[model samples]
Target: MEYKWVVLTNTTLGVIMSSMNMYIVLISLPAIFRGLGINPFLPGEFVYLLWVLMGYSIVMATVLVTFGRISDMYGRARVYTWGFVVFTIASIFLSLIPSNSGNAGALLMILLRIVQAIGGGLLMVNSTALLTDAFPPSERGKALGLNQASFIVGSFLGLILGGMLVGYDWHMVFIVNVPFAVAGALWSVLKLRRTPGTGVVRLDLAGNVTLAAGLLAISLGLTYALMPYGNSQMGWTNPWVIASFPLGALMFVLFVLSERRAPAPLFNLSLFRVRPFSYGSIALFLNSLGRGAIMFLVVIWLQGIWLPLHGYPWESTPFWAGVYMIPMLVGTVIMAPVGGMLTDRYGARLFATLGMVIMALSLLALTILPYDFNLFEFELILFVSGLGGGLFSAPNTTAIMNSLRPQDRAAGNGMRQTFSSMGSTISMALFFSMLVTFFTMYVPNEISSAVASYGLPAQVASFLSSIPASGLLFAAFLGVDPASAIPQSVLSALPHSVVELLDSRTFLPSIIGPPFMDALRISLYISVALVLVGALFSWMRGGKFVYEESAGRPGEGRS
Candidate 1:
């Protein structure tokens, strides 16, 4: 392989491991909690679950821009190489955590994950800039396509790996990454050479601090809102959650002010003056907002409702859900490269706009499906959605990167990542809030009637009625057997036949499925609306533009 190819391969491996670790932890959460002797359904446990799932992404998003600027100041290759070492050490720590530390163990894991995110953020911020440096403008899209496809596939494969590993032992999920991380770190060290950074760089301490703190507060608040508060099904009304919004907003305003005053700002606001860069960013943000949480929604739908109803055991639902999702990954792999090549030849606008439209239609189609729809039909639509996402991702990213000058590409890419990450963070909050809203209104009454019909006393029935729908939804999310999660005292007092009826797989799904479907439809509708708006922004980007032609370009206005 050529030297550029070596760089691409090593960087691609880093992307794969980074993306894979994210989804693996998500799918393996149940087993991790089991291994730690924690019940995720319990009050404080949900908070731990939220932190484990959202903390890494939050840290990555917050640091990406700052790290990108740092890479530009120093050297992309140097930062990129160190990312591997940091990520490998974090993985070792995660896999070797002592088993008996309980909640303390969970907190330690979250802290270590933040370290991993710093490494991943550095890799991501530098990877695109490095590829752009190695390849000509005409070939940048193709390289990015392959890199993105690896990441998408890694995320999908993580689901399968997590399911398989957690079945035997949760520790396997972390341990599996050690060999790959070690190899990638060594390869990067020996084979990669540093690319010279832009000369005379000045650090923007104010911009970095304000932006990071603002984003952290916002993402943390939104993530915590997924858990139940004292009386509300959602924690949106919690004092801390309520405070985060204003605080984040104020900090962001200050960040903008600081950036404007800096000698050379952390974010070069001048880049947004490029029409393609501005519009493409808006489209990417909206597109990510619409699409980011779809995977989580699908996992809940499959693990909680479809799999169990279709005769899969609770313990096995996570694995089969991953198996069923294979078609989506296949679609992404097939579309990404083609889209990138086409964008290189023609233009990104058409492909990017059309992709969002297709994704919107897929969401609409999903909303109309019956709760127990045909498996083939479900897979087909999921494939369509993934195809649309893949088609959009490469070209949109190419357009944004190609619009910036060589020296500014790293920070530009970091800005792009910031929007993408913010969209994802907000998407989770939006979907969770919507689910809780509908579930709270409809599920409590249904549960009360279902338990009452099973010959339970009014007191026991009232207790069931009072249980928040958030708890029920989370129970389903974890693939918990609903009857088993009930208090042992109540179960002991009940008749044997009643206990058997409650314990049956049919019981919870039959009761919860309707309300769950209702909430799901609302969330899908929101997604459809968001993606259509993305298509509008994408279409308005107007014409092909590449920075290589900037000095004497036909579409100079677009650039």
Candidate 2:
């Protein structure tokens, strides 16, 4: 198979657009919530925030394989073109944003964002399949590596750009997509070639619906689980959480059975038959999981704790936080394609394994740092982690895609994407859970003791504790000073000394530093374990890309 630069360019554009859409809302979230007059840190608000952030991911994750399968059957360019159009329309609607200052307005944005996610799913599902088809097997690693780098680079810039755009106008975050989406859509209509599927199989609509439902249920359950439950810190024990998780899992089991029977399965379970494909996918899952939560964690650390502590105001936290995150870009810029080139020569095992080890070391590095850590030390660590991530991502993705039969590229790419997306969303949930659990078990006591140390009354300290841990939690998540997110009434309830204590940068940092650090440590170990295990799987994704017979006779399998 001959690979063209045009195909890579188009695919890279798709990757950038889809990925940028993911985090643009992230930096714009605080501003968006504020515009809607919603207290972003309030109880139940995190639900909206999570959806706006994860809804696209969930939709993409759920439908990616299905869409990929459809693209294979319907012609990849057909699905690809439609996705660009749909995504653009959604972006327009989001920018208009009927209202954001009230409950109804907020709900409108969420629904529209879900629409946007559907479009993104289409784009993401087919783009990799398209790229894989265009590139030869041997060159696929470098192609995928560069594509992966483009994806992350888009994300990296999205964080910084989103912050900047949203700071000036929240709507700009959504509006910014207009030009690119239009160009991509028009270009696809004019330039993208149709490559149709080979099989005469039927679409497994039932399997698709079941699996999508199952996955959506899990996401919904996990999302709501972040909310508060009575006097507890989080709603993990809530009925919705308890019921949704099991129901989703059960549906997934049923989905498996249905897939085994389906003639044209939405996800070709047979892809797992290849050891390298299966194992590489796991490593991809781990790679995403290990890195996913760091953005939120780092954002909180910078916006909520460090930057504010250093004198950046609450309103400016988002932009400055992005500025502080520049090191990640530096690392990826230098390492991603380089890693892929190295993988081309040395095989994927040792280099990919080392990358994960580097990531684990980086996580350990972050786990040990103080709340108000030094910049150069922290930036260096972030860059190294990004380097590792860049190293792992492309070669691993290349191996997974190349391991598959040419006919199965769609399903294969989709499966890899699903696992990676699930890993990210799950990582977010896990990190938040760990962070909140630690806060719940210890923050009250610590806050109380701290308040008491500041000579506050017992009643005042207790009242402060009663005002939902989520408020302060989001305060930290949003990088806002806790005093700012608090309700006027709650502030009134607190003693003069306690309010003063809570308002101080040092107070929140001093009290939160230890508990949050504990959570970070646990999260670090989890990431380390995942990366190391992923490295092993990446190693096992042995041999060079061996093309399927269906990849024409010219399918290049070796460098």
Candidate 3:
């Protein structure tokens, strides 16, 4: 039992580490770009910036199912352990990126992020399966709950940790993972036992390749779409994004057919045959879409709007933003174990439903927070929302994993993870699109007015306006100093008053406030709806994790 606990703990820690880094880049973006001495506002570099942020999620989404399938064929622990190794190595490589100028530094960071994504995919794909093998059906919820808790907790902490470290140095974002990675690797090798899987497993090469290619295309398209096209603040009209949609869709369609025909499929189509698994997977996906987007959006809102407007220095915003976010993390940590334990005894439906309901209320509450709101009011709501998500995650995961047959556990978990990955990736594209659209509608006039107000030459105002509001929004949102992102030549020529106005927190937020609020509120409405939908599906997931011809009773090997 003690040994099993060790295994679960190490594995969960690796997962947490892998996932935490996913969004750490968001808070640290300002520092990273500044460290690299790159102009974030350059139109061409916008795609790279978006890619650096979304690349890991994109890669994870593309490969999670394939890796999950492969893990079942070999060994879950074997694959999971390798993920930690690869992740650790990748972290070292990522940390080594020196502050070179131009595309070299940017490209290096994006490429390293892609590699980290691969490692993350390996870890997540096999997570549920490995836990399924270690814990009994009944206890799977609580176990997975704690694991799920770590994921969310890691996500929230990633922002906080990024703030703390990035102010000291941007490389700290990647370097911090080293000790955790090494520890997880050492513990995994010693503590984890292999649970042998059944059947003659042949690698589904075609299925894997097609699905990966399809998802990658979509991700690439979406990442680029965040760039400015022509005079547009966003690139929705880009030919590449337009063409890739059909191509990716066609490839994905082929992937499904290939999966159906393959003798040993990467994605076992049969897992969806189980009612609880299917519904639970769908609910998890929807909630994740809404949840994931909000996480990024909120960070932007806090750092871009609230934190700066509240008087924190641009460099100080990252740390203080993370500090303010403590309520969310603390609340999640406190609720996870209790929620998991409850799901073990009471089943997942009630808690998950109520939890989603709580999530809905929290989103609605967030809509009312002022751009420069009082901390106490905002923190109180963030804590409640965090608690709500904690409640929903464990029970929902418990139902999904426990629904499938023991032999199909890996595949089932993989499918669940695949849906989840899609949700998170899609969240980035959708949220960014909405925010950029808002930027276009709301920011141009304010910027033009500010630019002209400072007694700048007409050509200079024209030039600054031409740089694109999306770039400026990204700069502010990431907490980058306006002076750094813009050209020094332009800065020096511009009147002092205009420069200060352009640099001021009040100027950016006021211009962005209305439209950003429009999108933010609408997104919250969608989130509320999604949580309700998830709750309904969770409720439909039957009463218990009934295992027919299973390996062991609930809590058998679990500590």
lDDT of each: 0.80, 0.75, 0.75
When 2 and 3 are scored with lDDT, the better candidate is: 3
lDDT of 2 by residue, 416-457 (tens): 888988788777766776677677788888887887677866
Pick by TM-score: which candidate is best? Answer: 1
Ranking by lDDT: 1, 3, 2
lDDT of 3 at 467: 65
- Quote the positional error of residue 135 for candidate 1 in Å: 1.3
1-559: candidate 1 lDDT, tens digit per residue: 7888988898888878887887788777767766776654565465676667567767766678878878876788888877888888888889887765688888998898888888888888988888877777788789889988998878886889988988887888888777777888888878888767676577788877898788777776776676678876667789998999899999999999998899878777888788788899999899878877767887778877888788888777768887887787778888888888888888899998988998899989889877777899999998998899889888998888888777777888998888888788677766766777678789878877786677666655665566667766667666665556668897788778877776667777777888888888888888899999999999998788888644553224343
**Candidate 2, superposed: residue stretches over 4 Å from native:** 1-3, 98-100, 196-201, 230-233, 457-459, 479-507, 548-559
Residue range 64-122, candidate 3, lDDT tens digits: 77676677767788888888888888899988899755679889888888898788778
TM-score of 1: 0.94
Q: After superposition, how far is residue 377 of candidate 3 from its true place, in Å?
A: 2.1
- Quote the lDDT for 50 in model 1: 63
